[model samples]
Each structure stands twice: as C-alpha cells, then as structure tokens.
Target chain A: AQTVTQSQPEMSVQEAETVTLSCTYDTSENNYYLFWYKQPPSRQMILVIRQEAYKQQNATENRFSVNFQKAAKSFSLKISDSQLGDTAMYFCAFNMNRDDKIIFGKGTRLHILP
Target chain B: NAGVTQTPKFRILKIGQSMTLQCTQDMNHNYMYWYRQDPGMGLKLIYYSVGAGITDKGEVPNGYNVSRSTTEDFPLRLELAAPSQTSVYFCASRPRQGDYGYTFGSGTRLTVV
Candidate 1:
C-alpha cells in the first residue's frame, strides 16, 4: 500500500510571492507517477502538475512546478508568482505505473493573500 | 466537451434509504473511479472499473456498491445510508494507459441524515 502525506494542513502566501507545499510518500515501486491536484470551492479537482519517477528533471507548468526527490520519497509543489486563484485545497497523489488506483494525501488548504 | 458528468449535484437521504449516484463520461475512457471526500479532507477511493463489466473494490468500499455496464457509465449505489456516509462523491475517468490526467466531475454532495 502506498500512502501520501502532506504535513502542512494549511498555509498562506502573499500575492505575487512563491509558496511550496511539502509532500512525501511511501512506495516500493520503482516506476510511478506523482501528481498535484487543486480543488477550489467549486469542488472540481484540477491537475496542477505531474512528475514521472524516471525523469530527473522536475516538471514545470506555467507557475506550477514540482521538486521530486525519488530517493527521499519526497515530491513537493511550488507555485511561483502566486495569485488569488491559486488558493485551494491541494492534494498530492501517487500511482504505480501499471496500477489504476491513485492514493491521495489529506491535502493542504492554501490561501493566497493580497 | 462534457468530459465527465455526475447527476443529482446534491442529494439528501434518510436512514435506511438507498440511492444511486449516476456517473457518465463522454471520453469513452476504459478506466473509471468513484471517490468520496469528507469535509475538509482528501478523497478515498470507493470503487473502480477497468472497463465495461469489470469492477473492483477500493480503500473504502463498505456500504457501497458499483456496476460498470458500459465503458462510459459507472454508477455507485449506497444501501442503508448512515450519517457516516455523508460526503462529497466524485467520478473520474482516464485512459487505461497514458500520461494523461484523470478528468473529474463536478462532484455530488450527498448528505445522509
């Protein structure tokens, strides 16, 4: 069984600043996928960014990027130039390369302050 | 495109009542999943289907049942509803093998009183 952990239950960042949400997981599979999903008040889950374990270079999408340390079992999400729309419940998820099941973390409620 | 659609955006049920949460996808995805999200918490998988006529249990399948009659439709049924069953349910679909992310529905807010 794989478990994803987001230590921070809640975090706040000032507008136009950068913020990082920490995530760690326990998995024995050599190849897997890590993802960060955002859910706003609308309760719609939106994919933020994803990282493949085999890739050494971190994945960057617009202002969202990930710091994946496979050896340390850590995958953190970084939001640069944060905006108010970035405020949401962020979840870290994990799934094996061949598995259809995705394990999710408790989530961190992020608030972007203006 | 209506990627994923879940009916009855909000539903309330009494104890011992039974109801089905309808989910349908237009992407013709082979993999579909049902998950529940408690207030201020993350999501827990209830069940999943790899394709039509194939379904399996997930982390939290108790008090729930699911049937996959087609590649685009996966419905979750709850029998004898309890207060503990009150949560937001989500349906998602994705390709069996791909780097693509799952497309989630807006979710159904279910309240069991």
Candidate 2:
C-alpha cells in the first residue's frame, strides 16, 4: 500500500515571500506520480503541480513548484511570491502507474500573511 | 464546462436513513471517483468506476455503494447512514487520455445526526 505523509500541520508566509510544504511517501514501485492539490475555503480541490517519478527535473507551474527527491521519497511543494489567494489547505498525493487510486496525505494548512 | 457537478451541496440525515448523492460530469470522462474528506484529514477514495458498466472499491468502501448507469453520471448510495459516515464527499472525473489532472466537483457536505 502507498501512503503519503505531510509533516507540517501549518505553514505561514508573508506576501511575496516563499514557503515550502513538506511531503513524504512510502512506495516500493519505481513508477508513480506525485501531486500537490490546493483546497480553498470554497472547498474545491485544485491541482497545483505534479511530478512524475521518472522525471529528474522537478515540476514547476508559475509560482508553484515541487522539489521531488525520489531517493528520499520526498516531494515538497514550494510557493514563490505567495499571495493571499495562496492561503488554503494543501495536500500531497501519490498515484501508482496509471492507477485509479490516489492516496492523499493528511494536509498542511497554509496561511499567506499580508 | 461544468466539468463535474455534485448535487445537494449540504444535507443532514439521521442515523439509519438512506440517501443518494448525485454526481455528473460534462467532460465525457471515462473514469469517475468518489472520495470522502474528514476534518484535518485529506480525501480518501471510497469508490470509483472505470466506465459506465465497470466499478470498483477503493480504500474505504465498506459502508458506501456506487452505481454507474451512464458515462456521465455516477451516484453514491448510503443504505443505512452512520455517524462515522459524516463527511464531505467529492466527485471527480478524468479523461482516459489527453489529460493528467482530475476534474473535481465542489463537494457534498453530509452530516449524520
């Protein structure tokens, strides 16, 4: 079974500053996918970024980027130049090789301080 | 595209009551999933369907049942609700190809009293 773990319960970053949410997963399979999802107070879950296990280069999307360390089974999400809209509950997820099942970590409550 | 939509934004049901949460997608996606979210805990998959006639159980499907009669709709049924079943449910869909991320519905908040 694959399990994702987010150690940070809460994180805060000043506006325009950067913050990173830590995530780790346990998986024996080499082929997998890691994802970061954001849920605002509106309660909609949105995909932030995704990293393929085989890809060495981390995934980056605008202000959202990921630090994926396959050897350590660590995949962290970095938010650069944080904005008020970035304040939300961030979750880390893992999926194995086209598997329909995606396991999510507990979650990290992110607060973008203005 | 109303990608995915879940009906009954919020509901309160007494224990042992039965109700169905409706989900529909406009994306014509082949895969649809049902997940439950508890406070502080992330979403956990309850049931999923690969296509109209194919369904499967996920991490937590003991108390929930699902049916996929059409490609666009996948409804979840709670035969006899329990207090532990109180949680926010989300419906999501993903195309078999050409997309990586799953399109998720807003969610259905259900409380069992």
Candidate 3:
C-alpha cells in the first residue's frame, strides 16, 4: 500500500515571500507520479503541480514548484512570490503507473499573511 | 469541458436513512473515483471504477456501495446513514492511460444527523 504523509499541519507565509510545504510518501514502485493539489475555501480541489518519478528536474508551475527527491521519498511544494490567493489546504498525492488509485496525504493548512 | 459533475451539492440525512450521491463526467474518461474528505483526514477513497461495468472498493468502502453502469455515471449509495458518514464527498475522473491529474467535482457536503 502507498501512503502519503504531510508533516506540517499548518503553515503561514507573508505576502510576496516564499514558503514550502513538506510531503513524504512510501512506495515500492520506481515509476510513479506525484502531485500537489490546492483546495480553497470554495472547496474546489485544483492541481498545483506534478512530478514524474523518472524525471530528475522538479516540476514548476508559475509561482508553484516542487522539490521532488525520489530517493528520500520526499515531494515538497514551494510557492514563490506568494499571494493571498495561495492560502488554502494543500494536499500531496501519489499514484503508481500500474494502478488507477491515487493516494492523498492529510493536508497542510497554509495561510498567506498579507 | 463540464469535467466531473456531482449532484445534490448539500444534503442532510437522519439515522438509518438511505440516499444516493450522483456523479457524472463528460470527458469520456474511463476511470472514475469516489472519495470522502474529513476535517483532518484529507481524502479517503471510497470506491473506484476502471470502466463501465467494472468497480472496486477502495481504502474505506464500508457502509457504501457504488455501481458504474455507464461510462459517464458512477453513483454511490449509502444504505444506512450514520454520523461517521458525515463528510464532503468528491467525484473525480481521469484518463485510463497517462499521467494527467484527476479532475474533481465541486463536491457534495453530506451531514448525517
């Protein structure tokens, strides 16, 4: 079974600053996919960024980027030039290439202080 | 694209009551999933379907049933509602082959009293 863990339950970042949300997962498969999702107060889950296990370069989406360390089983999300809109519940997810199931972590409540 | 659509955005049910949470997707995706989100528990998979006529239980499938009779619809049924079942349910769909992220619905908030 694959399990994702987000150690930081709550995090806060000042506007225009940078913040990183930590995430770790346990998986035996070498080839898989990792994802970061954001859920605002509106309750819609949006994909922030994604990283492929075989890709060494981390994934970057505008102000959202990921630090994917496959060896450490760590996939952290970094928000650069953070804005108030970045405040939300962030989730880390894992999915194997061979399976249809995607496992999600508990989530990190992030607040962008203005 | 309409993506994934879940009906009855909000619902309240009494104990022992039964109801169905409807889900449909227009992307013609072959895979659909049902998940429940709690305050601190994140999202737990309740059921999943690879395609029409093929369904399987996920991490937490107790007290719930699902049927994927068509490619677009995957409905979840609750036989006897309980307080523990109170949570926000989300329906998601993804392509059968690819690394594309799943498209999630707005979610259905169900409160079991």
lDDT (C-alpha) at residue B113 in model 1? 86
DockQ of each: 0.66, 0.52, 0.68
Name the 10 consecutive residues with the lowest summed lDDT in model 2 chain A: A95-104
Per-residue lDDT over A1-114 for candidate 2, one digit per residue giving the tens place of the 0 to 100 score = 788999999988899999999999998988888889999999899999988888999999999999999999999999999999999999998888767767789999999998
Candidate models: Cα lDDT each: 0.93, 0.91, 0.93
Per-model tally of clashing residue pairs: 0, 0, 0
The prediction achieving the highest DockQ against the true structure is 3
Give the alpha carbon lDDT tens digit for every residue of B10-65 in model 3.
Answer: 99999999999999999999999999998666998999999999999998999999
lDDT of candidate 1 over A4-97, digit per residue (tens): 9999999998999999999999989898888999998888999999888999999999999999999999999999999999989999988888
| TM-score of every candidate's chain A | 0.98, 0.97, 0.98
How good is the docking of model 3, as DockQ? 0.68
If you assessed candidate 3 against the hidden native complex, which CAPRI class would it receive?
medium
DockQ of 1: 0.66
Is candidate 1 or 2 superior in DockQ?
A: 1
lDDT of 2 by residue, B13-113 (tens): 99999999999998889999999999777888999998999999998999899999999999999989999999999999988622266789999999999
TM-score of decoy 3: 0.97
Which segments of candidate 1 are over 4 A away from where they belong? none
* Tens-digit lDDT string for candidate 1 (B2-97): 899999899999999999999999998999999999999899899999999999999899999999988889999999999999999999999874
Residue-by-residue lDDT tens digits, candidate 3, A10-49: 9987999999999999988998999999999999999989
Q: Is candidate 2 or candidate 3 better by lDDT?
A: 3
